[model samples]
Target chain A: MYSPACKVTDIASLIPQRSPIMMVDDYIIEDELNCRSELAVGADNMFLDETGRLSVEGVLEHIAQTAAAHIGYLHRQAGETVTLGYIGDIKRCAVTGPLPAVGTTLHTHVTVISQVGDVSLVSAETSAENNPILNCRMKVAEG
Target chain B: MEKDELVKKMIEILADEFEVEPEVIQPEANIKETMHLDSLSLVDMVGLVNEEFGVEIKTPDLPTIKTFADLYDYVFTRM
Candidate 1:
């Protein structure tokens, strides 16, 4: 039961974060070590800076949740329960461009660089319509 | 790549990242203590390996790797 694509509802079932806070919308399962997710920026986005744009932290959380979804997908494929995971550390984080405008669709990509015991190091990047926005490497772990 | 070549290349990569002299890195060297690699640098090291070797190193497996020789052996087997 490998679903190549997932909707928002499917994302809810896979991850612990709920709406208003959950940044990921749709995801494409590239493989066990990689995944791509979509986030539709809107005024309703929870973490918007004063300019009515997604805050930098929001973008980072989107990247983190994308990694979490990848882990959840792996567990699902293995017939195990999806557990809560936190972003333990973030390294080499860089925001290259301005925050995407409302109604824009951000494409996020994450790769699992390393996984030791409870901690997994992941590299992630977000772009809107081929324009790079931000990228970073994060350490994720189960709670 | 031969073992010696692999070791040389790894040293070069690490030296460039850690801003240390390549000659200072030896296969028997303990990267953390010798190179003063903090936890963040260790994460960056994993990134470097993934970029150069295209192999994803697991954190759980990092414990088994301490010295440059250990890293070389693990990476060599994967390569």
Candidate 2:
């Protein structure tokens, strides 16, 4: 069992997302290059599809937020305030399995592949109940 | 690696990655112009070259590598 370094209650302070849009609920950092996050899909989730499952866009946002959380954690450790970030680009995104339904929890892992200047390239994989759901590479830039 | 082999490999790799024709990647042509590289794509190019050639391109050294020939020489000496 991997215990989260930051709980859902404290997530908002780390990442710059507010209500309805916030996708991550828990976060754990394995190292400077790797981190994991969790998102519990609820009935009121804004990105739910017509079939009652989380949408692909929702999963992508969750992965981006996971990367944001990693950068935010580093900023906090340096006594700096959290800065806003944007997803500059996404490549090689694929839905590998069924999307998670409401009441399911999404587990996401992020690896920082490289960082050049303010842009960080990261690879992300998300799974639900041990079933792989999505994988992609994203360029996240601090704004 | 020999300079000729390095140039051939670089052209093939860069052309494929940048979605350009190998014919357009001339030795004296400006790399950024030929590849249509923005900052993000330039980073991608750097990462790609690093992966392929095991040459770590420092940020400060980027401006000196303006053409395919420069990039070839850079990697050749480093490798």
Write candidate 1's Cα lDDT for A1-143 as tens digits.
56555443479877999976889889788766878999899789888888888888999989988899888888888899999989888878889998887898999989887765656788898999899999998988877
The number of clashing residue pairs in model 1 is: 4
Candidate 1 residue-wise lDDT at A79: 93
Query: Model 1: runs farther than 4 Å from truth?
Result: A1-8, B18-24, B35-44, B55-63
The digit string of per-residue lDDT tens for model 2 on A1-143 reads 22445443488878888997999988888777789899999999999999999999999999999999989887887789999989999999999999999999999999877777778888899999999999998998998
Q: Tell me the docking grade of candidate 1.
A: acceptable
Provide TM-scores for the models. Answer: 0.83, 0.86
What are the candidates' individual DockQ scores? 0.40, 0.40
